[model samples]
Target chain A: MDRAIAIDVSHLSKSYGSHVAVADISFQVYAGEIFGLLGPNGAGKSTTLRTLITLLTPSSGTATVLGLDTVRDADKVRHVIGYVPQERAIDRFLTGREHLELLAALYHLPKDEAAKRIGELLKLVELESHADRPAKTYSGGMKRKLDIACGLLPDPKILFLDEPTLGLDVQSRLRIWDYVRMLKARGMTVVMTTNYLDEADQLCDRLAIIDGGRIKTLGSPVELKVGLGGDIVSVTLKESAKIPALESALKGQPAIRAVRATDKGLDIRVESPEKALPAVLEAANRLNCGVEFIQYNRPRLDDVFIAHTGRRIEETTPSKME
Target chain B: MKEYWQEISALTMRWVRRLSREKFSMLFTLVQPMLFWLIFFGNLFQRAADTQVTQAPNYISFLAAGVVVMTVLNNGLAGGVDLLFDKENGFLERLMSTPIHRTSVILSRFIFVMAITSLQVLVILGVAFLFGVRPATGLLGIAAILLIGMMFGVGLTAISMAMAFSVKSHGDFFSVLGFLSLPMIFLSSALVPLAAMPGWMSFLAKFNPMTWAIDAVRPLILSGWSEALPHVGMVIVVMVIFDALCLYGGAKAFRRAMG
Candidate 1:
């Protein structure tokens, strides 16, 4: 019942002159799981992926892909790993099929087998209709699909998708999400890095929340939300004057962990919203505070991020948010 | 070794395919050298027969070998432009991340540059023949010209690729390329013979590898193997040393960048 490790990065650090891009990071990706490095743009997510992909050497520590040392056995490691970098790597002049065919050759795939695989990948990415068109003529989503097909050409054991959905439209992003799920269904281990909290929550089996080149917390989406120890209860008051009284009354309840006043309401962190809702309502009634509305929110990945990093993911990546 | 060749062939084919698709690039690759031959050098030395600076029947015959060597030089030195674009666009990083033999990246580029330069050499030679210049050594001499051009080209291409990785931006890369290539072309015998240049210019030309390549190729085109064979031998030795030094430096720069 033991899970196999597809990627093992231990104490990996990378520095550029005086700037440390990745600082003493360690994590493991189990086979068949979509592991995610969740962080903002400068959080060393791409840097970690780059180091593991062997495009970069770590300043210290070790990383192994399918048990091959990324630095010493880079060629062997690369053989079993597929990497789709943040930037599109397709040649604009080549058709989608030509791009895949070229990559198959680079991976040393046999000619007939490469041809067959290219055909299959073209259909899989839904680019069969546009496969013969020059990549420059393809839409953004088509080009991205071709890029993913290129990464998948070698039938790699572990696939690294670095910001795979960055700069993509919602539909395009969803299409990539489906591809990632399909990859996982086929039992391919995927390591994806993204600043999108929803992407990490929806796609990843487990994720490490990274910020400032360090891991703030790591676990499954459900585990991370559960680890915050409660559901969130946002109670809006009819008047701002009711805030102080609601805050005191809510803090008195044993089910409630913490209470803070927001601009529009009182946010109560409690063990169970179902049990605490009535108690919160009772507390507000006793305090003579008129309740305008109450919203019961299960802790989101964003809340988990905020709990650990003291800043919302959106706040950190303001520019990148759609 | 088989895998090595496969990797090099695949990568080289990528470049070749890209070049083939760009009709303008293919046209310019062939035409640029011929333009220099016809418009600039051909016109400048048209009256060389009336002057004592030349020994050949006409200036185009002497300039034929120079044009071929110039094509090699231009192709080799500008070879890094593609690599620079690859670096800028992230394709180079993608290739580096693959299971390829790292040397294949540089070797494939060298192969691509040589292939294009060879074709350009033929086009120049063919055009030169129409203007009354024939290689005295026949097909064997044409083979020698390709060998010498490729030998000298390997070194220049390596150095150009090295600069592509070492520099920060496209502007810097092209500026450095222009700085190095223009001086090397003018100082070498690509435009005129060593006798045609002033004594100081000729002294510098002896140290120029392009000068040695021209000296080796010109006689095969104009005077046959009897006079050209020794210079061919000397040029081969010089090219090997030059290629070794440049390839070493280029590979080192590449490793540093990858790190």
Candidate 2:
């Protein structure tokens, strides 16, 4: 689709000494779209965000925000973008109102404009009552909301959020998700990095799954999931040692589309779980492997990550279950 | 240019607000040195200090200059503590992400430290007055004293900021702060006249920037401009060179750290 590009990155790579944090990666974020860079820990998402925001100088290639080169025109770029770092950046001594006030002044908002905007942000984050209290007293979720408010202070055309909801309760996470949707509705371009599969599935118009500083796949969540193309039958053997036997047993079957080995089980994609389940169990029984766990679901982002990387993006199964 | 100063002042006000909110910290920052050092050390050395060498009527008067300079030295060297904490806690990174000039962060700290140093100097002098010590050149001399402290302070504060950005952690910063402050204070003629120091230390004091400051400030408090002017000129020259090195090195370290 033809759309104005908010961010354009080409051949971007960043290194700390000899260690490459972000390898040659490139993508364009269209204006007014919620874009996501989905990756595991240390997957260079933060580095890429920092580079686009001009906190870092890329080791190679170039990035532009609204056509302004990130390095050559960083000052201009700073004017048009707001950043919410992964770290808790609020000054504990400053009240929430004071934090917004300072951010306003840094952004060079005029006196009247800043006051009005600060009031609006305080209200927006629902920190109005606690705005006068020092941030040290605010709960973790409240702090994260304040952080989002700070990023929104400049009313930036593009917002770069590094793990916006890294750690929070379900309610807080939902509030943040709603806030993100509101920003998108307001016609703001948001580029966020997260490892949460569901967050990407629910929030992003498009995503680039990155691993080991490389982009593994890039597509809309539905498009990528559909690209994987079937329902998956997850079978966990009582003994994980029998995984290879199950893998070979399930392979070359009539209805089994693909057999991908996981740390604890085998993910077998099939045209129908009904057709595949009986075949999977019969093979497992023949191989003397007890079926400790079995699950069936339509294709998931987890499957997409596994499909590309030959490994899981998240640490465990409960991450998806929860 | 206007926006730059506006941002700088706003950031400076942020530091000021933090200082003012903690009433206890504010009270101690203003009054602690007077109670701990000016009253005790000044009175203790009264009889032992020689009027001929000190060139002041009593030890308290001579000690006033030391206290003023000492306050500046301490405040200047420790100016970067808040900045270091900001760096550690990620506020500095957050601030850096904004459009404001990066130097504003460091410059604002300098402004805050020097401003506090001025108030602390006046408080010490007011208490010193109760002890029967008065400046020979009066109000103008007081202004001159403040200027000397700031000039001397600019260099020290810049060096402190450099340390903040250069070091790996706050623990490292504080250790270096202790390592530098004790030797610099003891080696300078802050507590005693140059005549009282051992030959080697006296020779070393000749090179200490703190010496140039104390030598300059002492005359302003104990003597008049004629004697104070030459020392002031020497300190101005010394501090210009000192601050130049510090600020240059500080800018470099800041860029490296932030990058």
Candidate 3:
């Protein structure tokens, strides 16, 4: 709605017959920010991103990229936006140089400028030496670097990377993450989706955690973690105990908000762990029960996810978003 | 207009480079038509030469012209299979997302196939000359026939691309292409003269546009024009209609892909 937002979607939904792939989702990504969509395998992250990129039409609602309607002004959107799909789509028979050249031609670049830009991008991605090798001969990391370079060829204002590092090794993944930071430094707005929570924490300035085609929560990594409270304490009970007794014992504690049974243990969300843990241990002692474990680390993204979804993100093997 | 020209130039250049890297494919394109020219048409003309069935001095000249057009049709229709592979492999999606004019892709492919088809025609004509069938239409007739051959090529290219979207696999698409081309060639006056055939075959040949094209070009190979011009006009009209149908079909496929 305002000048700062780079992308906006309202009540977007997509359905194939009776199956809903994405439903009633709304969010905005601001300019010059690395915004991330964090979700599990079938959380409608790709579908939502595809709709925003104008690859798939939404069944209802509207999406805008750079102040242009995705459906009505798709050509304008395509001109200014670059999309790096999850699947590697480069021609394997073409060399890295040829791939970039073909992509530049597709973008309608003048031949001289296209060649110049390809040279710069090759150097930027450190693939200059291997530019003449066919993409099929390049390692996975090299191919991915070329793919990124291809996406950057048009000098897009906002780029969408759908699982940019889905199957790369740690070193290659880190390299991609590093370039993403550089892209941000150059004032490019990037929208990325990944199942890897730590990637969102390390790379994204702000993130939205989505589940079952809905935004569960949105904020910077630290903001979301801090909002979940300061520290977490776990107690794996050997046997089930009286619910009322345990609740009453922990009631007067200063920072503890709620305690519930998790699969591995009893979990507690608290405002401050340093002051809350002593009381929790003392309560356990009085109940003649053992505190299996107590940890005083900051809340992780998994905790943030569990707080909202009432289930672990990894436990559900997502076959389809529908 | 300039931008469209630039896009066409760039697309055509890329394919030119691809063909250079794919020399084996060139040989493959030449062998089928060449064999058909030398073998089946060779036997038909040899018998016709001994007998007096055709009005033309040599049946080889007539058969050679038909073979050249048929080669263009086969090669051009297969361009659709290339497009289908491009789509299945994600190349088309990548292309559509870019800023280039979509029409340039189809036109460039048609031109690429035409260029190769024209060269194949030259080879067939050279062989026919060596076999004592001088091309009486000379350079002008050769140019006219090649242009018509290109029209035929563009028509088939567009139709195959349209079918690519509807078909499930590359193999199925090629099978349909074969089914479409073979019958059209046989039903037309490609291998034999219409005068020598049965009434039913002659009627079918009259209706077949491939017959029109062959009938048009055959006169040039035999130093005659009076009979060829009318058939040439008919072939041109039919090619335009097929081109329109294929263009509309390709556009529908694109719209479906978009949805």
Tell the DockQ for candidate 1. Answer: 0.69
lDDT of 1 by residue, A295-322 (tens): 9899998889998999877533433311
Off by over 4 Å in 1: A236-246, A262-265, A290-295, A312-322, B48-50, B194-206, B224-230
Give the CA lDDT, 0 to 100, for residue A107 in model 2: 93
Instruction: Please count the clashing residue pairs in each candidate, in the order shown.
Output: 0, 0, 0
Q: Which residue pairs collide in model 1, if any?
A: none
TM-score top scorer? 1
Docking class of 3: acceptable
Candidate RMSDs in order: 3.1, 4.0, 4.0
- Provide fnat values for all models in the order shown: 0.80, 0.78, 0.41
Off by over 4 Å in 2: A223-229, A234-254, A260-267, A274-294, A297-322, B29-31, B50-55
Q: Looking at model 2, give its docking quality level.
A: medium
* Candidate 3 global TM-score: 0.85
Tens digit of per-residue lDDT, candidate 2, span B181-236: 87898889888888888899999988899998999999888888898899899989
Tell me the DockQ of each model, to 2 decimals. Answer: 0.69, 0.77, 0.42
The residue-level lDDT of candidate 3 at A305 comes to 86
Error of 1 at B244 (Å): 1.7
